[model samples]
Target: MELLLLEGVTRTIELPDAPPLTILSGVDLAVDAGDRISIVGRSGSGKSTLLNLLGLLDSPSSGRLVFDGQDVASLSSGQRDRLRGRDVGFIFQQFNLLEGRTALENVMTPLLYASGRQFWRRREIASAMLDRVGLSHRLTAMPHKLSGGEQQRVAIARSLVREPRVILADEPTGALDVETGGTVMQLLDEVARSSGAALVTITHDLAIAELASRHFRLDHGVLTPVSVHAAEGLIAVSGPAAGPATDAGEAS
Candidate 1:
């Protein structure tokens, strides 16, 4: 059930007039089916860089990255693309929906690329997904007309439409109000659980991080485990797999 694993992973970007900048270094993480992991970090803490690597949108500069037991470095770009499309679901803070399309159309986009039954029944599949997200009444609503929460829900439907093996949620509530954001996160967690997919959320809020079964903090390109129960009432969930790392309770 190990879906993704990263060991000694490092990502560096070359600068035009300076030495390479290391965005992430010596990071180790494992994601399993039905696991919920939260990574807390601030701006420039390499959270987005890590997200890209997890989603297979980018490769590591060094170290090993294995997705579903295959070495990432050994695969061609096309193979990676196909694998990512088939197994990874992405949710962004901005709810990257197509402005020109309706909610249903946006969800159907993924299945359109799949083979056989999925491709032929893209509309049916997409409609069912929207209904599952409580958007059946607004299937044809345009992005411009939907509220922020509605838009995010549409994005969620789209992500889950493919029934991906893992869900990568990047600051998923950054753009919504507290109440709406809470509702959205609950919906997301419920659907992901029902689908038996691993959920990985990267966020700056400790409150958000506490929802996961295991937590980690990323700072200065280093990843350290955090025990959600060690904060003297700061964390309340008593997360299942969180391990204590020195200074893990410090601000990110």
Candidate 2:
């Protein structure tokens, strides 16, 4: 199923006297359930802007964004909030956990806004999620006490606790060492697959990007398909060259 779709999506920031700065220009993408997509770009390449758009944290200046077949631009602010909380999950590079809260409490935070039985059973759900991420023993551990990899695992648990349809991971392993990052990525991919959630990861690491089934590169607000020839260690741009009408990739 097509969980998310973007067509001619453009984002611009206007300053008082200066001309408008185009952050993302005519970006088109289609993400289906269980799809793994990695987007690579350097700093200031609008990678975070795209992630914000995908996670419903921000809207495009011009164009359409569809989530679960509904036009997001048409949704009321309240409706958009509900949709984002219920259907979309985000894992940030900073491991945005509540500093004073325990790992379990941080994981249970999302369920506080849930309805009915879910809200009441938040602890149980959070516990199971943490366990799934191999952090069962760290339920009472504070964010400061956990290592970087463990903190990221806690963030991952929190992201998947709602069983969201899509997972938006922005530089999820950027703060960890290479070996630890690899392990964290493996756990992330495994959990996403088992839960049947589409994974969209944004990062500058090509090795990490290669883990996804499809890859794209964003430069100066332009998005393009990237074909990685593993054997030759070559990365090639495949279609659309530059624009919002560019194709992302085939769905697995």
Candidate 3:
């Protein structure tokens, strides 16, 4: 089943003195449960813009976004906020952990503001999630006290604490060394697959995108799927044929 859908989506931002810039143009995509999709592009290629839209952090200029068969554009602001909290989790390029909060506390944050759960119950769930992410020993350590990989794991724990249905990751391994990045990517893949959650990762590195189940590239406001094998060792590509889908306008 389709867990997420985008139809004829477009986004345009007006510059201070320049003409309106089209970040995304008539884009269509459908993501199913347990699907690991990657979005790749160079700087200023609308990859981030499209991700923001998928995460509900930004609205498109026109078109529809549907989640779990419901039209997201038809939801109220409060409804959208609730949906974002309950159905979507985000992993940013920057770890974005609270400096003062311990790893456990950071992971418990989503439950703090969450409704329908007792405080003690939330804590138990958060602790279990941290333990699952291999941060059981670092539970009491502050974000600054942990290694880069540990910090990222804590962030992952936080994102997973709420049991979200989908995860939108923006350059999730950008800050780590190659070995560490591979480890992190493996962890992400394991968690998403285990939980049956759809995953969308945005990155400029083809190597990183190779970790996903479906590989796609965004360029000049278009999205195309490239063969996973072809993107394995390539560093930079400019053509649409690099992926499996040549139609820059849609994805199945």
- Give the Å shift of residue 18 in candidate 1: 1.3
lDDT, candidate 1, 172-204, per-residue tens:
999999899889999999999999999999976
Task: Write the number of the candidate with greater TM-score, choosing between 1 and 2.
Answer: 2
lDDT of each: 0.89, 0.89, 0.82
Clashing pairs in 3: 225-243, 225-244, 226-243, 226-244
Q: Give one digit per residue, the lDDT tens place, for model 2 in 71-163.
A: 999999899999999989999999999999999999999999999888999999999999999999999999999999999999999999999
Task: For each of the candidates, give the backbone clash count.
Answer: 0, 1, 4
Clashes of 1: 0
Q: How does residue 18 of candidate 3 score in lDDT?
A: 93
Residue pairs with backbone atoms closer than 3 Å in model 2 (clashes): 26-244
Better of 1 and 3 by TM-score: 1
Best model per TM-score? 2
Q: Candidate 3: list runs displaced more than 4 Å.
A: 118-120, 230-232, 235-252
